[model samples]
Target: MHLMSALLISLLLVSGCKSTTTRTGPIAVGPGVTQSQSPSPEAKRYTYNSDIYLDVAIPVFNPGFPIDDDTGHVDYQELDELDIWPQLRRAEAKRFAVETKQALAKTKAFGSVSVVPNANTSADLYVLGTILHSDSEFIRLEVTVVDSSGEPIDTEDFEHQVSESFFRDAMNQDKDPYEPVFVEVADYVYELLTDMSEQQKQQLKNTTLVRYAHYYAPDAFAGYLSQQLESKRGTQFYKYELNAMPAENDPMLQRIEVLRNQDMLFVDRLQDHFAVFQHTTNGPYRKWQRETLPEAVRAREARSERNTKAVIGALGFIAALALGNNSTSTSTAVAKTAGALGSAWLLKDAYQANENLRVASAVIDEMGQGLDLTLSPQVMEFNEQEVELTGTAAEQYEQWKAHLRKMYQLESSAN
Candidate 1:
C-alpha cells in the first residue's frame, strides 16, 4: 500500500517537471510583437530631422467611471471614467512623431529634431493636434502645422470608425496591443508632411517673372487689358497670353511694344464709329477729342505701340508682302502711311493715306483670307477726316467717301 502511494506521487511530480532532454511549450518571441522585448542600440541614438513640439489639449484616459475624490483631483477621477480610446490616441500621436522623426532621419530629410511641451520656444515648425472625438469604437484626429509666424501651412482631419466586430476581434486577448489605427495614422501623417515640404521647395525654386512695358506701369495697364480680354473670353486665353510674355532678362521695350499693338487693334475697332462722328464734327487736329476720347483709346494705343515694336523686333517678323520684302512689309507700310497721313496715325490713318484700289489690294494681300488692316487716305478722309471741302482737301475727301462706300458694299456681299 505504501509503495503504491509513493509511486503515484512520484509520477505526478515527473509530469509537472520540465524535461532536460527536450520540451515543446510555446514559440519564443523575436524582436517583433511576439517578443517580450526588442534589442535597442539606445533611445538617444535615434536621429531626428525637424524639431516638433506637441500640444495635446484633449483629456486622456477616461473609462466613464465616477470620480474618486479621495485619491486625487475630481477632474482626474472624472477623466479616468471615460473610455480608453482617448488615452490610446494620445499615446499613438506621440508614437507617430517619434516614428516619423526616425523614418525621416534615415532618409536624412532634415538636420535634427526635438520634442517639447511648450509651443513658444521658437521652433522651425509647430504641430498642434486635437482629439475631436474618441470612443471605444471610433476616433477623429485633427492635426495642423504652423510656421514660425503661426501661419497655418497645412491641416488635416481624419476619422476612424471601427465596427463593433472589428473592435471585438482587435481586442482579443491573443491579439497584438498596438492597434492598426496607429500604423495607419502614422503613415498618413508622414506622407502628407513629406509631400508638402517637397512641393513647397519646388515652388520656391520655380520663379514666375511679371513682365511690364517700359513707358507705362505693367501692373495697371496689363491688369486693365487682361481684364478686358478675360471679360470678352475667359481666363484660359489670358493665362496663355500671360504665359507668352518674355522671360526675365528680355528687353522691356520689346514686351511693351507687343502689348500696346495688340491692345490698339481692339481699341481702334471699338472707337471707329465714335471716332468717325467726332472727326466729321470736330476733326482729327485736336488730338482725337482731348476731353473724352474714351479712356480705352489711350490705353489701347499704348498697348498697340508695344505690340508693333515686338512684332517688328529682331525676332524677324514681316508686316508687308510685296513679294520683294515680306519681312519688312509692316514697318514699310507704317512708314509710308505715316509720311503721307501726317499726325492722324491713332485713327485709321493708313486707310486715308493709301489709294482706294491700292488700299483694297493691300488689305487683300496682307491679310490673305481676312480683311486688310491697311487703310487708304481716301477711305480715311471719307470715314474719319472731317473738313469743309475746297480744293485738294475736298477732292481727296470726296474720293475717300466714294471708295469706302464701294468697299462697304463688297464687304457686305462677301460676309
Candidate 2:
C-alpha cells in the first residue's frame, strides 16, 4: 500500500501538474538554446538618391532653474552667445543629415543626404518639427510632415529621454554623445521623411509657395549679412539685428543699415523657402532657369561702365584745356572747371544709379518668375500704388526710378 502511494505521488509530480510553488534560476542564452534573431528593424537603411532633408531648429534653452518657467528654468544670458542657436542648429541639422544618410544607405537608396535651410514659402514637403521641450538632460519633439501648401501629409511625435548621469559621465570622459543623439533622433525623423506618400508628392508639386528676397548691397556686404543670421543664444537675434543696434546719431546711415538687414533677412527667408522647394519636382522658383540674369546684368553694366568712363575722360580734358589756356578769361576757366566737375559727378552718379536699377530689375524679374507673378512695368507700377508705401517699397521704387534715369541717359546720349 505504501509503495503504491509513493509511486502514485511520483507520477503526479512528473505529469506536469499545476503547483502553487515558485521556481527561480539563472536564465541562460547558449548554443542549443535556439536563440531568436532579433526581429528585423522596421526601417531597413538603404542608399537613396531621392531628395530628402533633415532641418533642425532649436529653441533657446535658458539655463534657469527648471521651476522658473513652466518648463524648467534656463539661464537666459547663456542663450545670447552670438553663435549659439546656429551652433545647436548645425549640430542638430548635421546629426539628422548623417542619420538620414545612414538609414537610406542601409537600403542602398543613396549614400548621402543634402542639408538646406527651411524656407516658409517652399519645400517639396515642409517638415514641421519643433524641439518641443528640452532640458539639460532630455528633449521632447513633435515632427509633422506637410506639403508645401501647408497641408498635413503625415505626422509623428517622438519623446527622447536620456540619463543625465550618462551625459555627465561622457563629458567627463571627453566622449561625444552627439552621434548617439543624432542616430536616434535622425532615425525617427528619417522614418517619417522617407515614408512619404505619392499623394504627398503630388500635393508638394501642386502647392509649393513661390518667394524671393532682393538684397541691394555689394557682394562683400551681402556675404557678411549672410553670416550674421540670427541665432537663438538667449533671444532670437541675428548679427545684423536692428533691435540690438547702437543708438544712431545718423538716421540715414541707420536707415540704410536697417534696410540692408531687412533685405538680407528677406534673402535668408527666400533661401529657406528654396531649400524646402528643392525637395519637390517643381522646385522653388526655378533657380536653375533664373541664374542667367546675373550674366545679362554684367554684360549690360559693362557697356554702361564704358560709356561712363568716356564721359568722365571728356570732362577731364575740357577742364585741363581751360586751365592751361592762359589767354582764357577767368570766367571761362571757372565755368569750364565747374562744368567738368559737375558733368563728372553726374556721370558717376548715373553709373551708380544704373547699377542699382539693374540689380533691382534682376531681383524683381527673379521674384516674378519664382512666384509666377506676371510682371509688366505697368503691373509693377500698379502694385506699387496699391500697397501702403513702406520703406522697402520706397527703396524698390528708388531702384525703379534709377532704371528710368538710365533710360533717360541712354536717350540723351543718343540724341
Top candidate when judged by TM-score against the true structure = 2
Please list the Cα RMSD from the true structure of every candidate, rounded to 1 decimal place.
40.5, 32.8
Please identify model 1 stretches exceeding 4 Å from their true place. Answer: 1-113, 162-415
> Candidate 2's residue-wise lDDT over 218-321, tens digit each?
33123222224443423333222111212345333343344434334433433333334324312332232233334334534655775776577577767667
Clash count list over all predictions: 35, 35
TM-score of 1: 0.24
TM-score of 2: 0.28
Task: Tell me the spans in candidate 2 whose CA falls farther than 4 Å from its real position.
Answer: 1-44, 47-118, 165-185, 197-203, 209-415
Tens digit per residue, CA lDDT, model 1, 246-356: 444545434434444433332233234323332333222122112212222333344455455443431232222232254357667776454434323322333332233
